[model samples]
Target: MTADRGVSTVVGYVLNLGIALLLVTGLLITTSGFVADQRHRAVEEGLGVVASHLAGDLATIDRLASTSDAEHVAVRADVPEQVAGRAYTIHVSPDGNTTKIQLVETRTGVTVTRSVHTSLTVSESTRGGGSLRFVYDDDGSIEVADD
Candidate 1:
């Protein structure tokens, strides 16, 4: 009777330890996936805000170039060098009636596009993100380039 009593207690302890380890492993795996999803969401929102700001800046420069008598207009855009811990690219392209300002992150390939309403013609160009200069030339053309 005494031997049988000790056997059941030892078996119970071993079973409990195994169950606890399994539960902890499962929790770690699930939380890792959740963390990755949250990181991706943050990256998307950050890119979107940057794209919108650039588009607004482009529109402002266009208005000034079209209405003012300035021969060469260069407006410095205050933009971040990196988005979500990664460098990005800025692309300006014509999309039908509106011009599209698209930002693409370097490693992640996350892209966000914003449209600007401008009468002045925007040249299709791709430039690295960071300090930027929007130039309105004497010939009535607007271009974006690295500052």
Candidate 2:
């Protein structure tokens, strides 16, 4: 009966280990999804803020370019190079009479768009995120490009 008792103890130990392992695996899987979702939200919010700031900057440039007598107008915009550890691109596109600034995350494909309240027309362009230049082009349109 001693051998039987030993066999029962071993079986119980193995079963306990299996249950603990399963519980840990389950917890990891659940938390991993939550983390990913949180990360995506962060990226989206970050991009939105960036887009708004860029739009505001574009508007400011438009006003300055319209009022000033300077032949060449260039404004430097200081923006982050990366959002949530991901690189992104900035796109300036004209939608009919309205101008839109779109920011797109390279890896995750997250995108945010904001309208620029500018009197001057905006030329369509795409540039990587970083310090950008808003130039009053000779063609009488605002352009966003790499610095």
Estimate the TM-score of every prediction: 0.85, 0.93
Q: Which pairs of residues collide in candidate 1?
A: none
CA lDDT for candidate 1? 0.87
Query: Which candidate should be chosen as best, given lDDT against the real structure?
Result: 2
Report each candidate's C-alpha RMSD, comma-separated, in the order given. 2.2, 1.3
Candidate 1, position 11, lDDT: 97
Candidate 2 structure quality by residue, lDDT tens digits, 15-97: 99999999999999999999989989999999999988888888888889999887779888889999999899888898876
lDDT, candidate 1, 59-108, per-residue tens = 88988999999998888888998877778888899766689999888576
| Count of clashes in candidate 1 | 0
RMSD of 2: 1.3
**Candidate 1: regions farther than 4 A off:** 1-14
